[model samples]
Target: MPLSDLRFLALNAWLKRIFNADVTPTLISGDASFRRYFRVQHKDISYIVMDSPPELIKVLPFVNLANAYSDKGVDVPQVIEVNAEDGFLLLSDLGDIQLLSVLNSDNVYAYYRDALRLLDKVSLVIDNGESGLPLYDAAFVQLELDIFSDWLIKRHLVIELDEKTQNMLKTAFSFLIENVEAQPKVGMHRDYHSRNLMLQNEQLKVIDFQDAVLGPVTYDAVSLLRDCYVRWPDALVEQLMTQHFEQVKSSGQLDRGVSIATYTRWFDLMGLQRHIKAAGIFSRLKYRDDKPAYMADIPLTLEYIRDISARYPELEIFSAWIADSIIPAVEAKL
Candidate 1:
């Protein structure tokens, strides 16, 4: 990964060339995406260079969205320089304040409330009657649900549901989709979890927001509370959810068209769908992608699916089947 032969080196060089800034490059940590990053230091000056290989991930969308957020007074990483052709960017360092490093059981409320306030602010800033991001529409949701079927059911289980079971699944999915479609949509940070929230200067700073989109109002909230990397107690989640519903309502996004009970139901069902999607995605990551850390989260996610499915008697037969047969079998090992 030397500068001369690196795939992203040229792109990094091109961005540096714009500022005529000489840099001493050092590799930096990156998350699960195909993107990588580096820290460059030269003449006592420091900047973070995001090395997103162009062939794998586009730069314009991230750049444009970050710019849009910044323009709206949100604290996004400043784009000091960029080379769109090669997918490299020199950005202002947000500093060493990842939320995970500072979080604990006691301070979750304070930090979460702060995060919620920021979310509310962003919702306010972007409510210009149009969302610039792509909608996580019906098609996108269907694709996600299919991942659950393909990876979790077919691949992991090594079996197919019978016609009766399959029909029940289809019915459950129809309810899920109908519930998802009925909710009000907004610009959502698709992966707004603890790992993505940074703590720059004791204030929560959002990152990994490039995947932001127009999605369900509950998507990010559930992503936060019922995180893949962390789990909170059900009581706490419910309390915070009540607080969040109030915030959303006061923010003027609530139209009387969707009843509160209906919205709550949508939120529950949508969470069930997302948990299933996450379980499948995590399982696939371990089994197919050679990333094994995710396998540990699968059981908890499956349990969530069982718990939620039972909460509604309309889903009793299906939930009972999953809880009694599928989940117990899978839970023993996965």
Candidate 2:
């Protein structure tokens, strides 16, 4: 029998044991990680069964954060059952509608306002004691910056960086890291974007939050406003950014003295760091994991890098290089 079939049989047996009846789960989807999801209906209610391979991904962090965040009034899926020893979890289904699917020019501002309100609750959640979220410190920031250089520029694109080019990237990365250091740290949903947000019962529920971290206050905000998968007009994005700035300030998450100009710089640079990492991650997913669909998103990531980097004097050369060299390479290759 195929390994997948054997795994399915084992999962079925495990579910049967829990319910004391025959239970079959239909595959839903696999995410970017090493986990698979299945939809199971029992007692006329739908639940999501997360099948995270023990050897590949740990189940405890997700369980820990889900409970912690839910207690703080965040609309995360409730955990119903756990078989952590076997890397399986049964959770309340948040449904199939992603926030991205429903967003339009007409409703984006209103919808995004609600999403930003949810962030107030999310920012309140800090440490989870023994299962504390990791710090997104200098080392962490540098490592993520390296992924862009290693995967996208070197490995996938095969661009050998000479001495001057290497120095340019090093300086540019240092400036980005300084921007990260300038902001107040908060609980950040590292992948808090439209795709991971579910729209059920007219509310937004967060998912794919296992990688939450203690990072810049602007991280999640930039992730939502300057999303990788979708682009909003500059005016609309700026409006939402200012809205978030005021919301955070009023809630005391941000200092009242922080100027909108300073906050805008923080948001813009934080987004640049995220897009840099994402472009490389997309390449790594394509080449290492054989998931080529993510490659389609790389161009937008590059465009974001180009546009955002050009806005600052510090990153002018780096931005020019991207526009002059990197974008052409990517265009030709893709």
Candidate 3:
């Protein structure tokens, strides 16, 4: 039998032993990482089964973070069974309506308010300074920033950066990295966006949080506000920012004497770094991972970079290069 078939059979055998019932598992989704998820039906109940090939993906991080979030009263999946060797875990299903499909001008206010509340609640435990989640520090930030130049610029764009352009990127990246590292660090979801959140049991539940990191407080907020998947109006985003800042302040999470203006700047700059990283990753996913559909998001991500860069004088050269050179090249290819 093929390896995949063997793995499937083993997964079923394990499920049967755990539930004491014959179960048929249906594929649900796979992410950028090495893990795949399935929904298993056993005795009229639905459970999410995570299949992480132990050789390719480490299951311990997900397990540890899941326990930490669960203890903090966050709405996250409850672990049912874990097998580290085989890399299978049974979990409670958080239902299907993702925050992405339901968000609109009509109801975004209420939903975002709930999101900020959850963020504030998370603040309580994020700084335990002991969870041992990997630090998302300057090195990680630099690695992500380099992806744009390595994958997107070289492989996808098919253009070599001139010396001047290369220097501009170096300067731009250094500025972004410095700004990110200067912020208050905390336990961050790392990809807290609409799609990773589900409206389950009339409550907002977070999912896909295994890569939680000790990073900037604004990283997740930027992921949500300047989401690549969905766009929100600037006015509304600013309002939500105010709401989040107020909640953080009330929770004693905000730094003393940090004005809302400064916080907003941090949020915007953090988003620029993330957007740049995402642009490269999306391109890499298309070329290397055979996920071409991700290229659809590149234009929006670039738009974010262009808009944000235009606001900072230091990024003017980089911004001009993007508009004069990169944008046209990307448009021609697309």
Candidate 4:
């Protein structure tokens, strides 16, 4: 149903009263998430209307953050009118080009350097106690990891693992949790990557930031560099990572001689957890929503977790178990 319907009758009526035209909702990109965005054109003026089903989605946090960032002069979408009670929000349309699509090996280094500059700007604003987002604490990190057990292991994999393997898995998660929890928490985009970044007017306009949290600083870097949607060569990833480290150091985001080894460990482990979560999420989408396209990407996500986890000698015991037991079993089934 479009916004020109009974559900949005009050909203449409309100939009007419406010914006003064016949507004028709046009669907924009739909993602795995419950929220939806639509374009509304009245005369030559255009806007985006976010339709978030109230029962399944919450809007206040995103609203608050958007306003905060807006106040701080960040180029986020401007909120036009909001029906908080019914989850309808009218916003300024940023445009069609996503930074993800514009990015390539040719000028990736330059573009990413600018992107890091933006992150640095965000850090400065956020660090001044302006943004009051929650941290991805030990509990949350552990909970994210549990998505694998609940969604993948039990739900998708549908296995009754023997006690020994179960214990080993538990130990693996424990190790992962300890390392992940130890990193200094910073404001995370939560979904920071090329896809959420739009190239509007040759500027990187960030979106999909409703779930931002304070997490390991390296998580965003890894998410941006080793994006699940796009792959880059290892050398390029390292180059970008190195550039980020240098810039953050100059920007005072890092202290001199912070353990590079530990940061790499955090990035690798975080990728493992995120990749595992994504694989199961993709499977769930296929089985539950009949969206089989997601299933096509599961193999790459699994390979990422497997390949990265295997390289660490310390992670060998755990990776071998996942490789030999968990993934193979899930792959055969899902």
Candidate 5:
């Protein structure tokens, strides 16, 4: 028997035992990770069942963060049941309408404001002693940056770097790591963006939060404002950025003495770092994971890196190299 069929049979038996009745789960979708989601109707109530392979991905972090974030008033999915050894979880359904489906020019600012307000609550939930979230330290940042070079540049694009080009990347990466370390550390929903946010009954519910970490305050803000899946005008982004800037300051998450200029620089460079990592992940999803649908999003990621890197004099060489070498290679590949 195929592995998928065996897993489905195990899931079905597990569900039957839990409900005391035979329940069939309909497939919803698979996410970036090694997990599959199913919608099951039992006693007229719909629930989401997650099938995470225990060997590949653990179910404890999701359980921990779900409980923690829920306590802090974030509308995450409620955990109903769990079989930790078998990697099965039953959760309350948050519905199918993602925040991305409803956002438009007319309502983006208002909707994003509510989303940003949610971040305030999320930031307050800090890491406790041992069982807390992991730190997004300097080494972590460098490892992510390396994915761009390893997957996109070398594996997918098959580009060989000379000594000078390697040195340029080293210098640029160091600058980004410094920017990450200089910011105020807070609880970050590392992949906080439009697609992960769901709108049900006019309330925003966050999902895909298993990878939360303790990182820079500006990281989540930039992830939302300069999203990989969507783009907004510079004027609108600047307005939203300033709004978040004041929000973090008022909440005492950021120092009041920090100027808008300094905050904006942090936001821009932080976005550059994220885009660099995203481009590589997209490529890896194509070649390594056999999920090529993300390749279409790679162009926007590179465009963000190019445009943002050009704004800083220290990154001038890096920016020019991207525009001259990387962009064209990606264009040819696509």
Candidate 6:
């Protein structure tokens, strides 16, 4: 169904049921998925209406995790009403200021300190087996990597790789998966970056968390520090990572045998893996989903891949391929 029909019927029905008033929804934003969020004004109050087609998007994970995170006192939206069959929900509004819009050099340290605190609290909740989220296992990691080759390389870049380059990517993929599996498993807000976080009333409210997973401990941290949407200096990135390391250690989430050096390496390698995956997702969003705005972010994502891959011996060949072949092709397209 078109968004108009969805808004008129399913959304109206949910709003009437919840508020008993006629409410007109204003479109907020849409993510990479089929889900779209809208803002509704009712009786001098604001609420968010989530339209997630039941066939393409499931509302249960978001609902369940919202409850779980709320129980742990994490800042998140409150579900006031839910219509599972229609895949519509009425939630408490968390305002519109994304962390990205306000993050700058002057306040980055303060803002990131708060982000790390929230992350540590969430990690504690997961460590206690309270999250009940799915695992981001080796198979899942490899599947994410495959999108880079399928969408970014072949579909977007239109570059056909030779047998040797293909084999090198395979090797790099395997090595990255091994690195991911070596870390301590914890709760990951799979897309925990600037865009998904809301600064509401001086507190950060986490949103778009339906993709929460039991994954590598460093994944979300990397997603925050080495964000694809916004880039920070290397020195500031390292400093923030060190701050997270101390917090994780105090939370007792860091593995006993993993030293700070080992953890930082894991963070860096995981960042490269995620940046590669993100570049492909952005390309797929552009070519397949007709969302070209994401194309603007591919260069930074690839830069992350190129810079980090060159520093490791195991990824020497992969780094060379990116520098010599991938970067030039992507740059020319941009």
Off by over 4 Å in 1: 2-5, 15-24, 124-131, 256-260, 287-289, 325-334
RMSD, one per candidate, in order = 3.0, 1.3, 1.9, 2.7, 1.4, 2.0
Clash totals in order: 1, 0, 0, 0, 0, 0
**How well is each residue in 296-328 modelled by candidate 6, as lDDT tens digits?**
999899888989998899998898888888889
> Where does candidate 2 stray beyond 4 Å?
1-4, 129-131
Q: Which ranges in model 5 have alpha carbons more than 4 Å from their true place?
A: 1-4, 128-130
- Model 4 accuracy (lDDT, Cα): 0.74
TM-score of each: 0.87, 0.97, 0.95, 0.89, 0.97, 0.95
Order of candidates by TM-score, top first? 5, 2, 6, 3, 4, 1
lDDT of 5: 0.93
lDDT of each: 0.76, 0.91, 0.85, 0.74, 0.93, 0.87
Which candidate number has the best lDDT?
A: 5
User: What residue runs in model 4 are displaced by over 4 Å at the alpha carbon?
Assistant: 2-11, 124-131, 286-292, 325-334
Clashing pairs in 2: none
Candidate 2's TM-score reads: 0.97
**Candidate 1, clashing residue pairs?**
97-199
Model 3 worst lDDT run, 10 consecutive residues = 121-130
Regions more than 4 Å wrong, model 3: 1-4, 127-131
- Among all windows of 10 consecutive residues in model 6, the one with the lowest summed lDDT is 123-132
Q: Is candidate 1 or candidate 5 better by TM-score?
A: 5
Which is the winner by TM-score between candidate 1 and candidate 2? Answer: 2
